[model samples]
Target chain A: MEFLGSNWIVVVFMVVATFIMGFAMAGISSVVGPSRPNKAKSAPYESGIPDIKPVRPQFTARFYVIGMLFVIFDLEAAFMYPWAVNFDVLGMGGFVHMMIFVSLLLLSYVYAWKKGALEWV
Target chain B: MGDQPIWITFIVTFVIMIVLLTSMAYTTWYERKVLARFQDRIGPTRTGPAGLLQPLADAVKLMGKEDLIPEAADRKVFYFAPMITFITAILAAAVIPWGGTIELFGQSVNLYPTDLNVGALFILATGSIGVYGIILGGWSSGNRYSLLGAIRSAAQVISYELILGFSLVGIFIITGTMSLKEIMFRQHETISFGPFEIANWFVLSQPLAFVLFVIAAVAETNRAPFDLPEAESELVAGFMTEYSAMRFALYFLGEYISMIIMSLFASTLFLGGTSGPGADTYWPLGIMWLVLKAIAFLFFYIWLRATLPRFRFDQLMGLAWKVLLPLAILNIALTAFFRLIGNGQVF
Candidate 1:
């Protein structure tokens, strides 16, 4: 709690610093930079040919699948960290508990693999 | 730690910010020079002596160039995306332990900006947030190639992030702490084998985790071989294809700074940050040691960029999901098994 209280200041400072640096750079460039926006210049670059369709085309479902799997595994990894940090204190109980958790996750991984969900195609 | 004067903390934070900005500028020059050596050609010799001032010249040129916005672009998202990238990249530095505490003007000051109990998790969280810059930038640009590039980047970062997080579980297990400062302090003690003493760096004990961490880190930063995000041949400039002038520079700055941050994290986690020989006798030596380790990692990143060919997109994703992720999980299991047996809690 004490750490959080002191560190929030640091966090706020960092956030403000990032914004200041970003805006300062943007402002300087905008002030100094040339602004000659013509019709050809403003169009999106597409190998010199004009764009025919809208940019937001339908993407593959694989990306969505990867995202779902990532969330599940990322959560697993997140849970494992706190447990790992206290492995000594947790002793045998923690070891067995983590193994059970991991084994269940591994089963899901295997199921994903078997179902071809891991395949990029 | 909370008792320190707020002004003093601000000054320290400002100094670190300056250092990060300067280093971020020089890293581009460093990469070019090193890449030139690897390719048997001289790089950027015209700007200043040995091109030491090339970054300054480049900054001036970028600032003077036209700031272009595409007609079809989402103006707000396009403009702020780079800012998002730059912000997240810089935030991760707040928790890094640059060195042990040192006495300045008869007052002890920690070398780190702020020490958090969950410092490691803070880094991971910030890293995850960085992807938004790429995704939103690419999507808002109204360019098909940019969208494809962003999708590739999003997938790459997400997959490898798991490996990166899992790889560090070994360190957290061994040290019994997530605070980088505590981990560094833990490494300061020497371990002996037969009559020889060795620094108790996590790299020596957890070699697999170190390897996995480095691999995933490279992918995480979207650097070469893993640089499918900005494959110049295919996607023009990736998410920054529509960006020009300072907007593009923000993304560029974000990339290099993230590389440096990852190098710092690697050194802190595996190489016993700031804990080299002679560091105990002179505290400043600890900072020097930390800087040296980080530079070595940065050089390694540049070397790999110069040497390795980029992987195909499918191969890139496959390596992360099939190889690195599983290996990371195995590493965690192995760590748990050894720790349990060593403690006489299993067997």
Candidate 2:
């Protein structure tokens, strides 16, 4: 009820517009476009090929390990962006929070290395 | 508290959100059409006059489809993932100063919801919360690609978020206020450079910071040139591989909404939010001017998507930490020095 004010009228128009537009478009397309539903047509797309066997490939956990390593470093980068942006304004609080974040992340990086997640094959 | 009804603000925001969502949904169609034009092919002309209804069709298809949950996935986290994404997307829109106040009941109410002194910081916080959705969705998926994509997503957000935040510090130093509404209002008091207007828009004064902000924003939103996580050629839809129906749509909506939020934020922060010619004289004109500016940024987002190639994970991280981080910090230093010298440098 609170969200039913006049201001919400614009939003309601938006929602209805999106819904009506989307439904109408898709419905119209279905009517006009060819609808040939075959077993082969419904199969999971694999570049126009029939699957011989379900291939569950095995990869060295190394792919995941390196990925995790990348994430750790990437997260470090993320925290620094805002801290750097707010450094002057935030002053000591910003600096301290950033250091703490870095320290915690560094510790995890060390742990990952100790756990051998950084090794290449 | 304030005298104006909270419901009024809520209703206003709700409507804005709906408009934003629908616009984002159609942006997808626009992007496809534009990209198709780039590739020399027609895209979706069949769905209501020039394929304008394509986005609507997409939404219906997604909603009507069966919602699937993997057996190995954690149901609690799985369900919460989409909600988390959606919330983060909506929450970040709170601080964007859409325009100046509008008169209602003999008093004027600010178009923005709340202008915390720590408005920029608030954006950062809410923006970071979005990572939780991707991380949880990836972990809960019980699929390797999804997991990898999620991890990549977290890293990407984390990496670029820093540079992004850092770049804004320059703006803060120059403006000396974190409240976006205050910043816009402050812009009205002009600094004349001998009959030639030199300092009005932050983009005019702090071009470096503006460029860096746009780059970091692109990375943060995981758009192309930084879309490694969701690179269809590689990860098969990244963290959303296993998702289906409306659940998948939630993530989709989150991404587009976040883009819109960023565009609005950029408009408010750097492009004078709602301030323009005759903006000071009329309230509604100010709002229109703001929306027009914001739409410019939105078009830029679409333009970039259509033009740029997705960046490699390594290159993205490198650009953020090595390049953008240093550049942002440098801008901050310059702003601070100028502020100290003049006590008034246009940010």
Candidate 3:
């Protein structure tokens, strides 16, 4: 098993502290604040008219396309992080290997850009 | 790296928490005052001397205001969503190095909370998940405008986040480490250039990456010019539309805190964080430099807000995919070639 370090302990404390911080902010506000409720007040807010709309509206394909592209490119970038961090030890051979890999990803990116899949209004 | 006592660690962590929270509160005041001066008006003059207590007063007022939940809202998600943004933003600050270790009461106490080998990656990962709060909050509000706002934000965040990650790739390749503390220290190594001695800050070598990073960081924080999600004229505060009182206050806090964290993150990565004249002899000067650099970046953020117009949605997406991505790739390729040259692998 990988040994747990002191750094992880500080991190845990930080997580716990911030969690409490959020709760304290919200909890104090809820307790100290008033609770006067009415129909008009509870309605979903908008600028002027505040009209109610259809529930869970269907979104266009543009969002999903962007999401998928993000997943693909983000993964490619994630793969590069370790390689970049080890660049010095890895030397010229690693440099050539990474360049080839990144160029392929860029080519694919270019293909996506040309396919009209990236267009949004 | 040291086996410090658990109690001491706890105390240090607690202090860091207080600092992050306090800096976040003051950042709001700083932004307002800076923007006010830019517009030729004094901001928050009545609350206290120079309105220094305005953030405190605002916090009390917000806490006292009645909390509201829309009748059609998902009560659980709406209640919890703001916390997601708040926690993630606050968590990133834990890894930021305030300065080198300081000797405190016969004990060597590190100025930073922690230094993960994957510190840079940790910040980016938190940033990636940070958008879920917006997406979920908007969806749960049960309104079309909220839904649209969420969708736009999801798209915007993902696109810009890619640029943010890629921009750092140049620094990673140059430094050969993802640890923020290590990156900062690496930048402190001076290289002589004829008449002038210069510290090897990444901003000097990888200038393109720095520019890309600033643009991407501003968009990630949803500051003006990139504040499409919360564009009041369009989506009416976007995912924040259906929120009020304490929940609203948390989101507001989260944004400002994220701004501060991003500023610190940028300084740590590119500006030779905590490395300044006299910083070697007097350690507090390092912290002072860190604060000054972060504040400068924060000022730059407010300046952009006061200067630029918001980008159209399509234009924002296009710039990320078409412009920034290719430039980032080019930067990586150039850095790699230079690395090879430095390694004596190329003539």
By DockQ, who's the top model here?
A: 1
When 1 and 2 are scored with lDDT, the better candidate is 1
Error of 3 at B307 (Å): 0.7
Worst 10 contiguous positions by lDDT, candidate 1 chain B:
B1-10
Best by TM-score: 1
lDDT-superior candidate, 1 or 3: 1
Question: What is the C-alpha local distance difference test score of candidate 2?
Answer: 0.70
Alpha-carbon lDDT, every model: 0.91, 0.70, 0.87
Per-residue lDDT for B95-191 in model 2, tens only?
6776666787786666775555666776787788889989898888766667778878877787777767767776765666777778777666567
Top-lDDT structure, candidate number: 1
Question: Candidates' interface RMSDs, in order?
Answer: 1.0, 8.7, 1.5
Q: Where does model 1 exceed 4 Å of error?
A: A2-4
The sequence of per-residue lDDT tens digits that candidate 3 reaches over residues B1-347 is 45556687677767877887888889999999999999999888888899999999999999999988888899999899999888888888878987767788988877777888889998998887889988888889877678888889889988999999999988898888888888988877898989899888889999999999999999999888999989888888899888888889888988998899999999999998988898778888888999999999999999999999899999999999899989998998899898889888863
DockQ for each candidate?
A: 0.84, 0.08, 0.75
- Relative to the real complex, the DockQ score for model 2 comes to 0.08
Order of candidate numbers by TM-score, starting with the best: 1, 3, 2
For model 3 the local lDDT of residue A36 reads 92
| Better by lDDT, candidate 3 or 2 | 3
Q: Which tens-of-lDDT digit does each residue in B1-347 have in candidate 1?
A: 54567778778888998899899999999999999999998898988899999999999999999989999999999989999999999999998887766778987777788889898999998999999999999999999888888988999999999999999999999989988889988888899977999899999999999999999999999999899999999989888889999999999999999999999999999999989989988978988999999999999999999889999988988898888888888988898889888888884
TM of chain B, each: 0.98, 0.93, 0.98
